[model samples]
Target: MQTVIFDLDGTLADTSGDLIAAANACFQALGHGEVLDPLADALTAFHGGRAMLTLGFERLGVDTSDVVDREFPNLLVHYEQGIDRHTVLYPGAIDAVERLRANGYAVGICTNKPEGLAELLLMRLGIRDLFGSLIGADTLPTRKPDVAPYAASVERAGGVVGKSLIIGDTVTDLNTARAAGVPCILVGFGPEGSGVARLNPDALLDHYDGLDQIVARLIGHPVLV
Candidate 1:
């Protein structure tokens, strides 16, 4: 089956607000009182908890490595508790996925988030059933930009690696697709906004509504609708 693998954080949803809040909770416990800004630090949040913590520590002139290692677990606890507080699915994301599935495609997620957290977020969002498989940061020995997890995700989704494409929002995803010899579509509406275009993916997705057309064109399948 042909497959469309999506990146969870910025590709399918805007998880930055909640991610930043969790990182802020870590700083708040240390009396730092919210060192990262939601709007300004959103990109860092999508990068991962460690990146956010490192950025906050840098802003406070502290040794980032030690604090990050110590507070990383706390950040994950906070994030798991309130993961959906400010997270929202990108508009039409579900509809787009449904369209693809109805048109004979298998859909799945491959994220840099830990597997447990990714499952929790998808379950809480009530969209866990949409994906045939989910490969996360720790789901395998390595993560994105490496071909292992990507290939695993595709195979688990019942897709041939040679017939798959990735939908993502970062250079990590782009590099992963390139390494796997597959096409990638980067979202223009992610935390990096239209600047994601600079990565020059096989296609740019400004909205989920255009996904069918883009996927069809790149994968050489006819759009069902």
Candidate 2:
């Protein structure tokens, strides 16, 4: 079956509010003062947790690596508490996944989020069963920017590397897909801010609605959303 793999954070959902809350909680608990600006969340469409932490510390005129070792778990705990506080599906994401599956494409998720949390979010969003398989950071010893997860997801979808497409909002996703020798699609509206053009995916998508057209081109039959 044709396969489509998606990244969780920026590609499928807008998780910045929860992420920012967690960052603030970490700073507040440490008496580091509130550091992250709301815009930092927008910028995070590219980088994940570490990037956001680095940016927060930079804004606070502090060195992040020094505290990251201690603060990482705290931040994760804080973030998890509010995981669903404001997370939302990017526009057309649901339609895209549904239509792709209806068209006989095996859809899966390959994300760096921890497996349990990713599954929680998808289930909370009521899209858990839409995917044929889900791969998360903890699913294996290796994570994205490494090909293992992508290869595994493709295999779970009953396909090989050459027959799959990886969709995500960051360069990490593109890098992983490239590592696995698969075509990549970047979601323009996700975290990367404005430099997504440089990632050089096979296509840059602004909305999930546009995805059906892309799938149509791939399968030679229009996908119904």
Of the candidates shown, which would achieve the greatest TM-score relative to the real structure? 1
Residue-by-residue lDDT tens digits, candidate 2, 149-210: 99888888776677788888887888997788777888888666457878678888877888
Q: What C-alpha lDDT, on a 0 to 100 scale, does residue 158 get in candidate 2?
A: 73
**Residue-wise lDDT of candidate 1 within 83-123, one digit each (tens)?**
99999999999999999988988899999999999999999
Clashing pairs for predicted structure model 2, backbone only:
45-191, 45-192, 46-191
TM-score of 1: 0.97
Question: What C-alpha lDDT, on a 0 to 100 scale, does residue 162 get in candidate 1?
Answer: 89
Error of 2 at 22 (Å): 0.7
Model 1 RMSD in Å is 1.8
Candidate 1, which ten residues in sequence have the lowest lDDT sum? 216-225
How accurate locally, in lDDT, is each candidate? 0.93, 0.80
